[model samples]
Target: MDKSIFTTNAALTPALGYSTMIGLGLFSLALAYIVRLYLVRNTHDFIIADRRIGFGFGVGSVIAVWTWAMAVMMSSAMTYQWGLSGLFWFVVPNGIAVMAMVPFARILRRNMPEGYTISEFIALRFQQSKVATGIVTVTMVFGIILEILINLKGTSVVVSTVFSIDWRVATIVGIVCVLAYSYFGGLWTSVMTGTLNTLMITVPAAIVVVAVYDRIPGGAEAVFSAVGAADQRNLSVLRPDAAAGFGITLAFGLLAATVADQTFWQKVWAIKSRDVSRTFLWAGALFYPIPICLGMLGLVGIGYGLVPSDFGGDIAAVGPYIVSHIGLPLTLILLYVLVILAACYSTIDGASAALSSIVAVDIVKRYFPGTSESKLFVITKLSVLAGGVIATVIVLAGIDFTTLVLTTYALKTSVLLPLVFAILWPRTNTIGFVGGIVLAILIGMPIYQFVGELSGTLAIVAISGLTVIVAGLLKPQAFDIASLKDANGATSAPTAGE
Candidate 1:
């Protein structure tokens, strides 16, 4: 909280009385055009860079997409709320990432050559059945919408605060910038921008962490030692009090989710070689650690007299807090703007591309088999555009972090989780796979809606687990097992034709 380079109003103002929002808008527009020039093309290109992505780009997107406003903010928020248990949110995901990489990747890389989405993967490998695809699609699309909305809200608020403008304008400005860039370059542009974003955010974030700590009382050690009273119970990987209070049922919801996250799956399919995908796994292994560092910073804030005493503090404040506290050199301000854009758009673009690609290749072709590739491509792009509009609207509706997280995780609970678990466990029969999904909806939806799990994690674990169990107990169907085995066999850079 020292050095003087970022005078509040000065940094917020544009030179020569420029329309800051409009200038930011144009800057965003230019970025989008550059992305389009670098990337935009067919549906296949948009979804997985036509399966031509290199190591750094793929690694960068995979990482950036993983850390949106929620990921970064929530990790800190959790730490603020629960002390060490908060760290589990990040740790679990990394653990889940490792859990997924062992059996999932090689087959995923081999089988889905131009993999567009989770729906396409399930449809192509298992049944291409309407029931199956519909089930997965509904959950994934909704989850993505929730994720996007949360990110939009975070970015909008940050921009609004920094610029002293209305949040709504910030939201519109943010979305337009992303949509414009996405409109131009497509996936190529997004990935390139994503890599730049990772670097932009990482450097400042690391520095902010170090600088903030040096200034804080007792630094990290004092913060950690003092964080003990924040937790009501032992810091279990699965918090039992929160678990029972919230009705959590699945010990591995995070694991089930990682298996089906379309963001990372697209990354898996984009890479040129199976080995490059390994780079992502390594990156993922280390991905959640950033949250821990960020969370620690939040604890430090509490340790110092910096935290407010009047009301309950919010840990999501780690962003604005760090940026404000880290005085001097002022580069962090510029760095944060870049990070916000990167974190927000990297996921949004990838999500848009995945949805569009799946619709173009998998959904449209199935219904209108005779449609030409060019026409299918148009339809897919249009669908993506539609999805973008819808997602933007959802954000406009205004959802809090708890609502956003619950909406996404619960939806995934009823549909995608069962499907993913079925894929992961060899013994899971198709009957079980299908049944589990349906049962998850019936059981989870009621709990999510009527029981009001609200923001807690319990509902997600329970609903998803019940679905798998119910589905498993149902009559096994004559599934096309050979295809799955074939896929698993071909996971590690199997011949493209395999």
Candidate 2:
């Protein structure tokens, strides 16, 4: 329990902690500002990069944005607990969700080319129902909250575990860094910074794997054997408990999360028309590895006999738990900090940009009909700042991280199946859309609140989908997909930025 360097149980010195955060985080901010200066010509550029993102940037942005704190930390933590089956269950659902969005991205581009967020699609699809828009907006805002929670968890873990810094200070530092550059460039800034951060994340991850390889007991074979001994089913890809419980729940939950998330929708709009499928495919393929590689740290830790109790029972501490045991040099720890910062910033900027677009396009213009584009642009920046501040307050309040994550996913699941059906099925009606979501929340949340996380999630997806299908059957009404073509009255005029 002694906290000193000689004991190999010390917090990162204050000097090193502050220096690493400022060095890596601020440099990314500076580079982001420069990119914004060249790319940010108008509101469209700020929100969706003028809807002309190239394939490389598109893929990088998707991977970076989606690789939130949960992707790196929780993915490993689950594997630490559930073993190989855990990693398989976690990564597959997360990757599949992004890949599955490819066709929808093409459809959105072909129809609502000027669309800024998924809410626009909802508003257009259910023109007569402000309730639908309201529900979607609320759900998207919750998605923003989910983003904040992710970075909050990442920064808090790195700072608290490594530096002995109060998690609040880390939260404040992260918020300031993300808001500063995001305020300037929006999605263009996110994509460019994401490209850089991807390198930062990739290099460190690769280095860690090589550096730790020799140290792992029994090497890969020993790690697998230890995992199996720890839990009879741990090393099995089809571990029954994982396959039936966490796997099924996470599959439905993540599918809902990706579909309902404005961050993903914004990416869909940002990339070039021809590159939509390729971008998503690349993003999914590239991102799938980072988590798996990181998850290896957990298995190695298990092989070395490390346990959750070492990190105060917080599963997110799995990565740090392993790192601490490696007796890594301070330099390596600094590199680890940079990796965490990269993950945090990528998602924070993406969420800020996504939330701003929803506020600008869905809320501002809808309520204030005569709002000028310039004013709307200003409002978007303001929303980003406001969201960062709100998220900071929530993080500082010290909410239960696990519950926050599960609750948000449950809320999202309530609306997700209905939204998908509305978009893909011609017979899907507003009655189905609104009523199904309402009924799902009424029934599903209680399940989440009382029964269990997986049960609650499954209930929401099942009930929502069933309601949409049943309502459509009872009062079938085919909607012309072409009706969405000019939902926003956007013309062929190129943006000023373009």
Top of the candidates by TM-score: 2
Clashes of each: 10, 0
Candidate 1 structure quality by residue, lDDT tens digits, 190-275 = 67766766775577677767766665456666545555444434234466454443223333445545565665665666778555
Per-residue lDDT tens digits for candidate 2, residues 1-498, read 111211244646766777777777688778877977788877778887877889988888888888876577777787887888889999888899888888777777787777777877887787647898888898899879778767876787677777787778878876887788889988888888887889888889878765665555456776667766777777778888887768888888777768889999988878888898889988887888898888887776566566567666888887866665566766676776777788888888888888988887778767776777777778888999998888888778876667766566766887888888877898888889998888888898889779987778778888989999999999998787777775557421223442
Reference-based TM-score of each model:
0.80, 0.94
Q: Can you give the lDDT of residue 347 in candidate 1?
A: 69
Pairs clashing within candidate 2? none
- Let me know the TM-score candidate 2 reaches against the reference structure: 0.94
lDDT values for all models: 0.59, 0.78
Global lDDT for candidate 1?
0.59
Best by lDDT: 2
Candidate 1's displacement at residue 36, Å, is 4.4
